[model samples]
Target: MLNVFTPNRHANNVLEIKPEELKERNIKGIITDLDNTLVAWDEPDAPEEIIEWFRKMGEAGIEIVIASNNNENRVKLFSEPLDKSFIHSARKPLALAFQKARKGMGLKKEEIIVVGDQLLTDVLGGNLAGYYTVLVTPIVETDGFWTRINRKIENLIKKRLKRKGKI
Candidate 1:
């Protein structure tokens, strides 16, 4: 059961995931979480560094889609300026959104990776959908109320995963 929450890879942030590395792994698409994973939850736009990262990914022919549980308005405001595809209010940890992302990307499971900061939502959803998952440390220490609750459960799970050397 714990395996569902385990990510195939972990990184400090999305930028740490290099385009070359993803290319080498044959990962053609990315279904990434917007809040916390890409930027602080309160941030309204992508930072300069994140913009450049997206440019690099595009230069490498990698498609990216924002799959966020956030409201449509929030997701649209953040993603539009970047010209990235997106799915808002994606109730992740459920297979529906993950399947939609895969189908939308027109890529096979192995050709894409799910990247996010949450274990319960992103990692579990990705794994359950049969795609590789990458867990990134949240960009900010602060989180919204619901996320704070999820973080508490994640901490307990992390401790157990650590005890078993699975993290």
Candidate 2:
């Protein structure tokens, strides 16, 4: 059960995941959480560094889709300007949205990875959907009310995973 929350890899942020490394692993598609994963949850747009990272991924022929539980308006406002594909109100930890994103990307499960900052949602959802998952440290210290609750639960789970040397 705990294995569902475990990520295949962990990084400090999205930028830490290099395009070359992904290319080597044959990862052709990326389904990522928008809030706190790519940018701070409150941030409205992608910063220059994140733009550069996206450019690099594009150069490597990697397709990316933003899969967020956030509202459609918020997701659209953040993703449209960047010309990125997106699935809003994704309801992570559920298979439907993940499946939709994967199918939209036209990539097989083995060729894609799901990246996000939360274990309860992103990691578990990705793993359950049969894709590789990458857990990134939250970019900001503060989280929204619900996310705060999830974080507390995640900390407990993390402690257990650490005790078993699974993290």
Candidate 3:
């Protein structure tokens, strides 16, 4: 139902999600989307701010794993330099990739949070997998070809959710 697409929390961007708040919530790990969720879809790498965010999370002893639908090369390239774990070609909106990321983190479902920009992929997938989900606004308003299609559908869903005041 619509609840599956609704996030438990929302933030303007990933940087707005503070480590202190997460720690207070007892969330020890993050399963995050890569492209527009963390940076522009076309961005080749993480920018300084994103890097610093990762550093903060690390300093707080919070583990992070990137789960991206993009190819291995793209995900690996972005993740390796950050020295973070990743799952590529993740096929989001499916539970398998989320499960893989959770298992890799070795964190219980209650100890993890899923962060992403898209509801169809990120929120739905995370909710279905029984994890707390945070929907951060995409770093850029623009999206890649396939994501644009999802965005259109997401807009419609958002409107409905708004009418119901569930978002």
The models' CA-based lDDT, in order, is 0.94, 0.94, 0.94
Cα error, residue 145 of model 3, in Å, equals: 1.6
lDDT of each residue in 49-85, candidate 2, tens digit only: 9999888999999999999999999999999999999
Off by over 4 Å in 1: none
Cα lDDT of model 2 overall?
0.94
Steric collisions counted per model: 0, 0, 0
Off by over 4 Å in 3: none
List TM-score per model, in order.
0.98, 0.98, 0.97
CA lDDT, candidate 3, residue 53: 98
Off by over 4 Å in 2: none
Candidate 2: how large is its RMSD?
Answer: 0.8
